[model samples]
Target: MRLSRAFQPTLKEVPSEAQIASHRLMLRAGLIRQTAAGIYAWLPAGLRVLRNIARIVREEQDAIGAQEVLMPTIQSADLWRRSGRYDAYGPEMLRLKDRHERELLYGPTNEEMITDLFGGAVKSYRELPQVLYQIQWKFRDEVRPRFGVMRGREFFMKDAYTFDADYEGAVKSYRRMMLAYLRTFQRLGVRAVPMVADTGPIGGNLSHEFLILAPTGESGVFYDAALEEQDWLSEPVDIDDSASLAAFFDKVTHFYAATDEKHDEAAWAEVPEGRRREGRGIEVGHIFYFGTKYSESMGISVSGPDGAPLYPEMGSYGIGVSRLVGAIIEASHDEAGLIWPDAVAPYKAAILNLKPGDSATDAVCERLYAAGAEIFLYDDRAERAGVKFNDADLMGHPWQMIVGPRGAKDGTVELKRRATGERFELSVEDALAKVLGA
Candidate 1:
């Protein structure tokens, strides 16, 4: 998008309301705007980033055999009541009454609703193992919502539900999702350590929270360094095999990782001194194997092999699609501005026209823009070179294709990699080849 004609409104001064790096930078860089306390209107660039993150999430979910489905944001309170959680869920759930005088609530999570839907559709054991997912907005009435999207009251999330016929099958589904989450984080260019966490209102003995290390995080983290060493994307675990999944699960969970709330100093000491890593962490995802919590409460069941009633074991997995935007910025920004990773950047590269009116610079930039206009953010604004440079850095595109009159005159462009601050002056052809991977 050309900055001159774009709706990207950048700020020179940080808003006082933004207390965190991601919050401040997001507003300053024109990624989002606060419409209400803890509620934001994602601007163009921000929406692009949000969609990119969601797309990655959807892809990863699909790879794990999860079928995509769209569930409602507003759930019937009756569903919660059926699950015996309407009163127990507390005020974070926005309970309300419709104009028809029927009770309803904005769903903070979808355990009860999904159980209702799945129960209504599948009655036989033929559909015993199924993973259904959705990328949708969720609401929680946080009394004090803060941290921008990181703790927003209404945010986009990817929640997947898994149903299995037996405890053993549920365990396999749970492990498969764990593997999927790790791979998803790796693809998003972040290392989110899976730590055993409390189930809370979700109500499951088995639960894990994926935390990204950041000083501004809400929880203190303790883990073995080896947990971060493995490349989950390359792991050879067969999702179809229970033994393989179990081995993978053991390989990961045995490494000793936990938040301060669950930290055991004895287990901490058992980790080799060299492998001990303690730091603050921001939660970006969570998974729970609640077994019969929802199915039993909602009276959801399918036929067993012998034709008796069976409550399908249930599990839910979630990745904070919107909060990840903030958590990623919290984990990866520098003094200049945000430093977006390649996979999740709104734009792969930015074309900065240092001399917008100058024919040579315009020619070079226009040529670069033509090469991949959709994938490039062309900063053709009539601004000073320094202004363009600063804005390019602030916007955090992975590559900056600097088009100055001097280089433009020789048909060369200065390409700078934003993450590493590495610059290379090359001919237009070479620059295009490098940035666009020609």
Candidate 2:
């Protein structure tokens, strides 16, 4: 996309309200704007990154046999009442009344609603092991929403629900989701550690919070250093095989990991000081195995092989699609600005026209843009070379190709890597080949 035509309202100075690196960079890059206290309007650039993260989540979910089905943002409060959670959910739930005086709410989570939906159509054990997922906006009116999207009241999330006939079946489904979450985060270039966590209002005995360690994060975590070295992507994961899944689960669970709510003092003391890691972490994903919590409360039952009515076991998995943008910045950014992972970067590379009016610089940028590469061309007429350089670094594209009259005259362009601050002089053709190949 050409900067000349793009609606990038980049700021000259950091906003005083942004307390975190991600918040400040997001504002400066024009990726998002605050619509209210904790609600935001995602601009074009931010939407691109959001969609990329969503795509990775969807692909990983699909890989583990989960099917996608969107649910409504506004749901009937009657469903929560049926699950006996209407009164228990507290003030965070955005409760309201429609014109007809019927109760309604912007769903903070979808356990009760999904249970009702599943119960209405799925009766027999034939559909016992089905998983449904959706990527949608969720609202939770935080009393003090801060850290930009990291703790926003209104945000995008991917939530998946799994239904199984019995305990054993449900456990297998939960393991599949765990593997999928690991893979999803790995592909997004974040090292997320799965730590045992409190189920909170979701109400499940078995739960895990996938956390990415960052100094500015909200949640305190304790973990084994070995967890930082495991390569989940290299291992073969067979979701359908219970034994294989069980083995994988055992291997991962062997590591000592827990969030503050579930932290075991004795267990943490057992580890050597060097091997023990204690830090703040961002909760990017969470999964729960809630057994019959939702199914029994909402009358979701399936017939067993013996012709007996039984409540289906249930599980829920979630990834904070919008919060991940902030988490990524927190974990990856430097002094200049945000350092985006290539998988979720809005543009793979940026073409900086150091001399916009020069024929040589324009020709080089035009060829690169016309070659069908996903690039952002800095062709703004009024911007100076220094301003363009600073903007390119701040925008955090993987590669910044600087085209100038001098470089073009010498049949070369300066290619800079945003993450490493490494620069290389290459012919225009070589630069295109290297970046496109990457």
Candidate 3:
């Protein structure tokens, strides 16, 4: 995409209200704009990143046998009432009434709706093990929504629900989700540790919160240092093999990890001092096994093998999709701006025409752009070399191709790595090969 044609409203200076680095950078980069307190309108650039993250979430969910199905943002309040959470969910629930005077709500979560859907169609154990997910906007009226998208009242989330006929089947499904979450975060170039967490409003006996450590994070966490080095991608994960899933669970649980809500001082003391890590963390994902909490309450039952009526065991998994964009910045950014992971970066590389008006430089850039490279070409009408370079760096594309009259005269262009700040002069073909190969 050409910068001149793109709708990026980048600012020359940081906004005064943005206190944190991520918030400030997001505003200056024209990624998002606050429409109201705790709510935002994602601009073109921000929406690209959001879509990339959503793609990764979808890929990982599909890998674990979870099918995608979008649910409504507005759901009938009667469903929540059946789950006995209409009164219990508190003020965060955005309750309202339609023109017909029927109760409605913007769903904070979809347990009730999912249960109601499952109960209506599923009637036997043959459809026992089913997992469905959706990526959609969710709203919770936070009393104090701050820190940009990190704690926004209206945000995007990928929520998945699983229904199984037995306790053993439910546990296996939960482990598959845990592995999926690890793979999802890893692909996004972030190391998110799975820590035991409180069930909170989800109401479950088994739950885990995937946290990414950042100094400016909201929650305090205690975990083993070894978890930092573990490579989830290298681990053998077989979603259909229950034994493999159990082994993966055991490996992860061997370490001591817990959020403040579930922190055990005795367990922390047991770890060697060198292995103990206490720090702030941001919750990027959460999973829960709630047994028959929603199913039983909503009359979601199926026939067992013995011909007895059985309420399916259930679980829910969630990833804070919009919040992760801010969390990724918090976990990995320098003084300049965002250091986007290549997998989630809007553009793989940025082609900066340092001498935009120069005939030779334009020729080289034109050839490079024609070679099917995913890049943001800086070909603006009124930007200086320094301005173009700074904008490219601030946007954090993985690679930067700088073409100038000097380099064009020499039949070369400078290819720079955004993360390492290393530069090398190469022919147009060579540069294209290197950047696209990455």
Q: How high is the CA lDDT of each candidate model?
A: 0.90, 0.89, 0.89
Compose the digit string of candidate 1's lDDT tens values, residues 170-220: 999999999999889988989999998877765555789999989999999
Distance from true position, residue 347, model 1, in Å?
Answer: 1.1
Candidate 3 Cα misplacement greater than 4 A, ranges: 201-205
Q: What is the lDDT of residue 261 in candidate 2?
A: 97
- Write down the worst ten-residue block by lDDT for model 3: 372-381
* Residue 238, model 1: Cα distance from true site in angstroms: 1.7
After superposition on all C-alphas, the RMSD of every candidate to the true structure, in Å, is 1.4, 1.4, 1.3
Give the TM-score of each candidate. Answer: 0.97, 0.97, 0.97
Q: For residues 35-138, write the lDDT of model 3, one tens digit per residue.
A: 99999999988988999999999999998889998899999988988889899889999999989999999999999998888888899998879999999999
**lDDT by residue (tens digit), candidate 2, 1-438:** 888888888898999999999999999999999999999999989999999999999999999989898889999988999989899889999999999999999999999888888888988898789999999999999999998999999999999999998889999999999999999998998999999999876565589999999998889999999888887657797788999999999888888999999999999998888999889999999999988888888887988788888888889999999999999999998888878898999988888888887888788888777874455555545588888878887888888988888988887989988998899999988998888887
Cα error, residue 363 of model 1, in Å, equals 1.2
